[model samples]
Target: MTATKRCIRAEDLYQIRYTSDPQLSPNGKSVAFVETMIDEQRQYRNHLVLQSLDSKDLTSLTVGAVRDTFPRWSPDGATISFVSNRSGTPQIWLIDAKGGEARQLTRCKTGVSNPIWSPDGKHIVFSSMLSPEDSFSDVEGESKKEVQKVIVVNRMKYKSDDHGYIYDKSKQIAIVNVESGEMRAISEGPYNHTVGAWSPDGEWLAITANRAENPDKQHSIDVYLVPFSGGEWKKVTKSKGTFFFPTWSPDGKKLALIGSESDTHLHAAQKRVWVYNLENDEQTCITAEWDVQVGDSTIGDVRSPGHPNPGAVWREDGKGMYFIASERGNSGIYHTTLDGQITQIVGGSRNVYGFSLHEKAQKLIMVVSDTASPGDLVEVDLDTKEEQRLTDVNHDLFAELELPAVEEIEFEAEDGWKLHGWLMKPVGYQQGQKYPMVLQIHGGPHSMYGNTYFHEFQVLAAKGYAVLYTNPRGSFGYGERFVQACCGDYGGNDYLDLMSAVKYACNHFDFVDETRLGVTGGSYGGLMTNWIVGQSNQFKAAVTDRSICNWLSFYGVSDIGYYFTAEEIMANPFNNPEKMWHHSPLRLAANIETPLLIMHGEQDHRCPIEQAEQLYIALRYHDKAPVSFIRFPGASHELSRSGDPQQRVLRLEYTADWFESYLLTAEKASV
Candidate 1:
């Protein structure tokens, strides 16, 4: 242990800054990125920053506590376009590359996002909300009213955790002139649209949308080409699965996209890169044979919102494309040819969450994070394979703290399936001494916990608790079979994988005290926690956040419940009532004997607060062990990740307090 270093606290989250959305200039001399920090008001303040590659000098482009993000350099590198709420709504704003006052470019009432420059830099295209009967001109003249409104529900997917009340609003593509600020909706529809990339000749814009019958009922989004002059869209992709991030090749002969070929399994389907030849109207999966999942699947709390996706970037010569993929415990940059020949460009024990490549200059700038650091921009030379750190946003905060080192663990499940995980020892550790340990499970059961910085896990380690986090069988970063193993099985083999992990850790690590064990997780992880406490009494304390207690209620309550329930569980409440009830943790609530802390977001539409309420009520009615409940008023499913800053801190504080109260004695906790 160091003399000057101290243990991290929950409030240290405010001191941790994050960097994301790195955009390389066309000239490859400087990079434009977004730096986000928590202000005194507990609100996120995101500002665009320009860093010179030659001198490593940084200059802030936008000012104040307002959010200014998604900075995209113009085709000529003379101006940068970004989205900002300075005008009270997230609208497109433009500033010169050299520096100056940023001017508002759009005044859309509903706001716009994902702005991209045209090939000639004369116009910009973005996505904005538009009702079925409203046009761009109507949106500009519209003003919101605060009076009471009537409620109408006609669709299955009517509410969303991120955006509530998806009634008649649809995300449509809109275009605006840079010089005149004249804008209008280019694609109008009842279905939502996502802007991709503009064709090299500036005649068509590629987008992803589901215009099929009953679009919301199925997970089918295909790539389509919309004319710049406005008309009917040309469907380019065969409607076989979900597709997104359509990028045009340098020569405009092909389009590189990142998506999947099957939508049945949804999250279990590995995101693959496919190239659509514009000449032949044929699509081919470039990474079909590669087992690794494409895109950044690593989960973390410090990641800034709206981090730009590093979609498939075509090489300058148009022979291959570069993209990011998750494998083992790292998200690395990879390149693949048209025939599925893949090559690893840069890989390590770190998470490359965001990236931008300058094909002509062979320069790659990526936002990389490890176990100790939040994230920073790193420049890599394609030819030389050299790397250089461009920013250190959290260096000072981390320098004064003794961050724990993470040890990767590879063990076998009870079923002989291999599993991956990481163990972080408590700060200021001493040999031959036993310490309480906390088994931290990740959400998504489909989302992987890789070599990324997690504030919650670090805080627990600082409080003298060894942290054990794992990517069980249901987690990503593994193959298709492993990821799909937990689906339809729920608390079956997935529960065994977690229990086997705890057994493996206890037997292998002598310092871990198996008697004083604690468990906590959120979302699907929360469901597992509830399931564990009901099935076993091995854990002394357990905290479940945003959990699902009853599958019957979750199917109709959650935003994506209608489809997510049928796909993941392979059963519905009406058709298979016995199966759904049999797998619900609430059904076995009477078996829980451990001290349980129930926490959930009041506005969490994903799991809904009622789920937490049901478990708490059931536990109290049965008088089984000790149970407590906490609720955040304005928080949602992302409470631990991107919820209110104050509430996020409180969630961690309550979690640690609950575990410490149950697992540690006063004398040991004081030590």
Candidate 2:
């Protein structure tokens, strides 16, 4: 008798743990990373973990009901500074890398973020929230529990999906002395100042902010260098578009930047890497000819914390740098020389989400993920580019579960464009039996569905449904032009690309049941799902999560709707209402013949929940197609990934049940 393995269920979400922000020690002998998991109380806990390379010993720096993140090593590696809410509000906390009780570093009223140790290791530079009316160093002991009972929205950028309601607040740079715990604001102004990197000399700090005359109307951000001793900020890379995240070279002569030209086509512009020289005050586009978008733009079921994604790391020699780019369905680390030569350093069909490098020790640590794994820490050889798996954080959870095998598929569209995607087979599949297939679409139309492990896909496979997901032309990983292709052509060719993949799968894969097809996606993927079900009756079931049905209204309600609607659909609602409505899925929602499920987060500001209300109401007018709406309270657009643990599970349960009940039970009922 053969033993069968238990398939992964929706409840497995709680069992999955997320590890990130891996910071190598100054001596490169140890690494400090944050591991986040759902606690017994149904809340999330983040703890700092330290592991030594010599003895292979791992230790927890901090533990218990709190979030300890953004760990940074001191110059001597004696202490580690992190931001934690253990004391009721998030502030800088310090702990010995050797393991001991953590001591609070800063007790600022406004929460602190992105702690960076100075070169001398005497001071730490961080940004904290401050009201527009408050001065830069407003450290008056105001109660942290002051609730904003009423929100007065004056600016166009009043609310955002990331920070919710921070219109009245600005993020200003502040410095905290390590020894005495004395803190003072460095760069103080009405505008926000995001810390990027410190000069090797410790005299200058690179930051980006929108300090324009009319910051709200301006779409681009400027990179500026502020003095550590408190002086006037100097505008560095005065690029036409929004460029940030300045990585300083070892010699501090040049700075590596990732941004796009915002002077024109702000919406369709692609993120490219550039190098700005301090001596001549000139910037060179390093990755412009590479034709790929910079940074890790891969989409998955797991949503990382608000920490900025890992960017370019300057070489010690200052001649080149190592950066991550989305290329052909995978986010790979590549090496780019100042002379415009590019080489793939750690190239593969894998997602390298985060990495840390130490030149003197010749050591490199990478946080990697693929189809079979959520994420794990690995050591990558700097010279040979060889990788060694260092941590198996999810090995125990994965050992007890049977995960469906994920395979990559590729086919050429009618327009001769090669499309890339992956397919997850139903768990415990029979050789000759067919199963219902669900077409999964990813958001970002600019983001690619690549090597990352998706918990949502596993849940569907556990329910005996094959999941098919693809990166259409508009998706990243392919190239700049491919991503921009979907800009003005919302549902035009991108919709066809999805349908062609579905047709190809049904014809080539005998395991898929053509008549019992289902489709689901979130964000832009959700919009595509709504479009698919509305335009085609071929889909028997559809689930749209945090989707937009009416682009005309989406232009006003969404955080970035005003610009995104114009850039994405190429139609300003004010100038072209007819065109915006024409591209909107709401125009076809009443024509949807498939049973639909509208899933949304009430606090979703990206694609506001109002979009869901409009979608459900439009479908209600017909009432022919069975439709239902589920709202997750206090959940943002990331409800599927990092929302409340219970709510996340409920989302997966609802999505899986709706597809199973309709694709199978409804199919049998008709028989």
Candidate 3:
């Protein structure tokens, strides 16, 4: 009998690609999306591509090293506008829909993003930072240098490593004449404002603003109405919570906004859609019991809505609104009436991102994705609920590879609470032989591991390891109560839930070898792996990536240390250092017996490389286990997703080698 492939390497992983940000033209004759490709040099870049409705005559609009995204069709569908950083900094660029050389629209020293064309297509409104010198005043009596000194940071989480430094120059909404290039700030203040939509009548522009004295401290975001001609802003709604992403109704009588209750933790917050009446200014929550959040943000603000694409659309008659909500285990598009009744319009195996509705043709052009495919463009008939795939970006990739099958699993925690997880067995398996198991952990104890296409998980299964991942108590997708379970108790119940998943997988799958188990994860998952080996020696080997080892030091060092340690974990560096140390994995390093490999980015401000250094030093000092540390230069916390391509490939290869040496071969394991 021939033996199955003992282990898979990084080179064996399939090359899968997908498209996103699908935008349909007003006439419904053509569709556009951001097509991402790995060049011959292995560098990732995206460009705008157009495809006709009737034929597959695809055309690439933007080219070269520049990455273009967020393509928005003009009101008349004559032009397309997008944001690109090809010119050193991200700026707005316009190109004719038919085809021509793209023209630069904005030339500010800082940068501009999210350009929205007015109703008449005569002007374009976008968010950007003006120069600090522009805000200085010329004193009457003294020279301009005599003013008192003040440091200004406009928005909450001003010092973001990923987005760079945000100054006192708030991202005010600026409008520019499409023809003459004349520009004016319609909504101006020390506060930050983002444009939502322009009323059909062109009298008012709907916008979202967070203008509190301490914008960072205030969790609530409010929507406002600003005159198109430029004047005082009118407040539409006020609350202790955050409210944003204001979309105007077609008739201009009502406004739709995404609201979140708080920011204690990712799961502790409740997100919903609310409609505000223009006359009474009364806000009604449309998603009261849906247990779904509507927006996405890099920072921890629950109130800030995700960037609006064609996903949220106003009905042509203005009697109803349509938005995408992730509930019932998947995200789907739903239409809600004025009476607060919601009807599911599109239901399927894939998640609906956003849709462009053509009322005249009764057709809905949307971006959807399943577990196997990354994402693709599709069209659905709103009336008939019939769907058809439009793009085949990943068809060849899927056909050539044998992907792992993911199944949802539920297991009871030690405390009788049920937990959710996803399990992926080897692609080609036998009945009698056992396979090595790898417990994969996700970052953001609050981030959920859903039915999505995860390249890492697929690659691991292809390498002959049965992979298991779970969304512990603090993960999203479940309601508020399920998420708050991990607030102050980080390594407590969440750790137990993961332990229970491992046990369940071992008991149910006879092909899993309990003795040859290996574990790996990044970010929060990295923290868990560190905590796991320190507490138990059940696993033969472990790898932790960008993990947190010492909480006391993290509180003072990390960018979000001050807020996250105090608000979320409810711990302080001065008073509760012991509790923080007790939860830290470094404290229990002496008990760790498994051979461990630690990987981190050199410039990760979120969880600095010192965290990995502390763990490595502790393990080596005690002489209890073999420990190795690898650092990627100039890399950040997002190395797994957006790191340098060559470095990312090496990182994955290093992780697989560590596991293969320890778990696959007994001779290497003993050494």
Steric collisions counted per model:
0, 2, 5
**Which of the numbered candidates is closest to the native, going by highest lDDT?**
1
Question: So what's the TM-score on candidate 1?
Answer: 0.98
Comparing 2 and 3 by lDDT, which wins? Answer: 2
Runs in model 1 with CA error above 4 Å?
Answer: 138-146, 666-671
Better of 2 and 3 by TM-score: 2
lDDT of the candidates, in the order given:
0.89, 0.84, 0.75
**Residue 666 miss distance in model 1 (angstroms):** 5.9
lDDT of 2 by residue, 536-576 (tens): 99988999999989998898889899888777888886788
Candidate 1 lDDT (Cα, 0 to 1)? 0.89
Off by over 4 Å in 3: 1-15, 134-158, 166-170, 186-190, 263-267, 295-311, 667-671
Clashing pairs in 2: 241-262, 328-477
lDDT of 2: 0.84
Give per-residue CA lDDT, model 3, range 517-551, as digits (tens).
99888888898999999888989999999999998
RMSD of each: 1.4, 1.9, 5.0
